[model samples]
Target: MGVDFSGPEARAALGVVAPFDMELDAELLRWLPDDVDMLMTRTPFVDDVVTVEFAREVADEGVVADGVRSVTAGRAEVVAYACTSGSFVRGRAGQESLLGVMRGAGAGEAVTTSGAIVEALQALGVRRVAVATPYVPTLSHLLDSFLGEYGVSVTGHDGLGLEQRIWEVPYAATAALIRSVDSSEAEAIVVSCTNLPTYDLIAPLEAELGKPIITANQATMWAALRRLGRRPTAPGQALADH
Candidate 1:
């Protein structure tokens, strides 16, 4: 679950399958309630390149089921596949298959960052979009194709070759990379990647870009809350109300 660290008074629970990176945990902690309990499992991956093999490895049913089962123990609510390109690379059908695994592991509701990004774009009524990410070239192209399948047009896109150093991508660089995109015909900007730190910049960037900004983490959190039958108050500019 993505909880804001600033709002310590409110607690929420979520089960997450993420890589062994503190950056993602740190970002989620910022918005998560202090008392929130998260059941987490680490998924191993080689950074930088987005490949079908990598996608398959992450979405391995046995691995995901084991992780989800460990976290949930017995209680069930919602579970999220926290990777953006990983899920998208697997394509829509692959994503649903992963969700099925999560449900099999005892998740009442299941979602992925890729699915959430699409849902967020649809919720905002955005059709044409420009996508940016701190991923390798292959992954970026895969994301473009994945979105196209959902009927979302990606006008332009770019990716950083930081490869496995994806976790090392700085927050400032992430914001700058997103800002550098020319979103002329795009209705919104999608900063894809939960591991990349883009949440804090969502509001300010939206004001400057004059369009909605959808980040992987933000969309995943919003989708999880919605699945739980709760509406999150807009903390950042992009999808504050909608």
Candidate 2:
């Protein structure tokens, strides 16, 4: 009798996988690691205070953990939240609690775009930052408070006072937001909110501002890679480039 050893070892494993949330029609996949088995789970697309208040309805841990278990066949290397406002609106302890849920649910590593922004800022050696968000002013102020707990200061910031229109804000307007909030004292410019497309604008904007521009998606992907102990040369991103 021959021992054909191929059962468990034969599984087609997708290595260093990262899972991030995507709303309908989002180009989130294009922003992730190409060499890894990247996957998506939908989060509520609306960028409103209601979505942030009713967190469980949108960034629900159960939905994410279940999706992770389903997609990676067992466990994903990292489960990263793609929403900035939703993750940060709850403040610091809240993010830790949010990641706690992901870890308890079976994630190898837990990260949120908001949490990553903190790490990215620290890693880039920036303490005071300028920020621009697409949410209403209330949400923007909440983000400022969130960063304070981490010892990072939002010396300057603004929001578009938007509801569902965050995704619709033009790149020019986003660039304008950066300029509006940015100051010489701010070591970095953080363009908050994941729904906005930012990667294409990162290089040009950073070049223009002469300071690091950390967007929601940029920090999310950067943190996912760092959690995996990776050091990819992600161009135009100070967090990854470091």
Candidate 3:
């Protein structure tokens, strides 16, 4: 008797806990190798507004713990909290606490979008960054403060001031925002917000601006895949290709 293998072998699984409004799973998948699997769960949906208060609600400790637990059953190698503001709203200490919560809830390894952004920046030896986000001014400032905690400087910043439907923002508008904030002092451009799509646009924008670009979802997936000793499938992305 004989048997044949018909499909790609599963090498590993990475669990992702996204915000209720996250619509970029396909984008995340594009970065993954065919052998790796992505298991995803979302925090409970709230009102449609995307605000600081909403980020707080989604980042509640209990919510994070439950979300981590939901994905642990799949035996994922790592669990990632995929909302940038939700993980960074409380700053560095809060980001550490989220990792603790995910670990306590059965994740062997844990990462968060904001935390991954910091790791990616450090990996590239980037110290100064330009920031762009779909959030309002207040939330944008929080991201700046979050990066500052890691000794990274936000040399330039701009926001779209959207209260909801951040995912609906097209790439052209995001590209415009990235260009507007880019400055000579910035070593990289950080596109905040996991729900904002930047997967296909990363390499081209990097060429246009002549600097590295780190987007929330890209960083989250990169940090998680790193735990598996694998690089993402992003061909020309500075952080992923690194």
Instruction: List lDDT for all candidates, in order.
Output: 0.75, 0.70, 0.91
RMSD of each: 5.6, 5.0, 1.6
lDDT tens digits, residue span 93-154, model 3: 99999899899999999999999999999999999999999998888799999999999999
lDDT of 2 by residue, 154-186 (tens): 888788877664666788988888889988999
Ranking by lDDT: 3, 1, 2
Residue 175: error of model 3 in Å? 0.6
Q: Worst lDDT window (10 residues) for model 3?
A: 2-11
Q: Give per-residue CA lDDT, model 1, range 72-157, as digits (tens).
A: 77444687778886688778887778889889888888888899899999999998998898776876778888898899999888
The best candidate in terms of TM-score: 3
Candidate 2: which stretches are off by over 4 Å?
A: 1-27, 44-51, 54-56, 61-64, 231-233
List TM-score per model, in order.
0.86, 0.82, 0.96
Worst 10 residues of 1 by lDDT: 28-37
Candidate 1 residues lying further than 4 Å off, grouped into runs, are 1-12, 33-36, 44-52, 74-76
- Position 116, candidate 1: lDDT: 89
Error of 3 at 33 (Å): 0.7
